[model samples]
Target: LLIMFFTTGSFADKIGPTDGNIVGRETDTVTLKFSYETSNEYILLYWYKQDTKSTPQFLLYKSARSANSERKPTDTRLESTTTRDSTELTIRGLKLSDSALYHCALR
Candidate 1:
């Protein structure tokens, strides 16, 4: 499977995926990492997944500054981890349908 990843942020607030594309097999585990920098005390991040010819779907959102603040993912196999300078989306037991473009946004 092939997965593409992207990120959105302001000029000063640098953010992007560690890899633009990734290749994996079924049942494999993949972690897409996005590096970000911000000065605000409150940090919120959103993750989206877009399949071919489909609108991006909201996967989840997390506040890096708050450990207990986050939106649970619709899928149990999906997990997110956040830090002061980066965030990651981890997909477990990957399938062919998991192949898509992922976008991460920082606010």
Candidate 2:
């Protein structure tokens, strides 16, 4: 699972996906990580999954001062976390078909 970059022409070092590969077993866990330096600005973070057979899936969302993620279909398998300067999207109970292209978009 090679790491995927999900960003565009933004200011230097504002948002980036880590470079490397992510490998995990079925039912195991994996995290697609991202780092950001927002300079105390508030932003909405989202993680998405797009596979060959389905449309883009809205997995989770996080924003400033929010303790919980607003997930689509109320799924517990996917969730996101945010701190002062970074965020992570964790996939619990991974499956074989879960391997696909993922993007971490910020707004």
Candidate 3:
């Protein structure tokens, strides 16, 4: 008899504001870059708002699989664009609410 196993994980890296500047008013764009080792999977990029006593809320985008995915919440203040495979995310019209830890995962 033989045994085999499989596992899944992601390689995440932060992009943009890498200098840790207090990103808020005046910041026009936020960009992030990441790389992964998987194929035929969808990637979900999320943004949240950090609060003192509560969980973060969704800020700008979600469920983006390709560089051409559409922005959500339709306020015309948030926009996202990406590059295939390389995993680059470009966000426009950044606001205070757009401040939070950005995360990416394969789904």
Candidate 4:
């Protein structure tokens, strides 16, 4: 099986994916990377996946630039690692159902 992903975000804020058209195979672990620029003391990062004929589903979110940050994922297989400038979403034990356009947003 093959899974493909893409990202979307605001160009004015300089936030989006580090790569586009990523591919992964069944049972493989894939990590999607995104970068953002913000001068605020804190920022929220979000991840979503959209399959064909459907809307994007919220997967997880993480907080950056704060020690008292928070994170939550909709699935146990979904995990997020975030820093002040970048965030990465890792999906483990991939399945064909994972094929979709993944999106990242900064706020």
By TM-score, rank the candidates, best first: 1, 4, 2, 3
Comparing candidate 2 with candidate 3, which one achieves the higher TM-score? 2
Listed in order, each prediction's TM-score against the native is 0.93, 0.75, 0.46, 0.85
**Pairs of residues clashing in candidate 2:** none
lDDT of 2 by residue, 16-83 (tens): 77655587888888887787766546567777777767766776678744344455426678778777
Clashes of each: 0, 0, 0, 0
Q: Where in model 3 is the C-alpha error above 4 Å?
A: 1-27, 41-53, 56-75
Better of 2 and 4 by lDDT: 4
lDDT for model 1 comes to 0.90
Error of 4 at 5 (Å): 5.0
Q: What are the per-residue Cα lDDT tens digits for candidate 3 across 1-107?
A: 11111112344532332223234444476555545444544555544444445655554544444433434645465544444343434556666555555443333
* Tens-digit lDDT string for candidate 4 (1-107): 44445555555566767876668788899888888887775677878888889988888778888744656775788889988889898889989888888888777
Candidate number with greatest lDDT: 1
Predict model 2's lDDT versus the native.
0.68
Q: Highest TM-score, which number?
A: 1
Tell how far residue 14 is off in model 1, in angstroms. 1.4
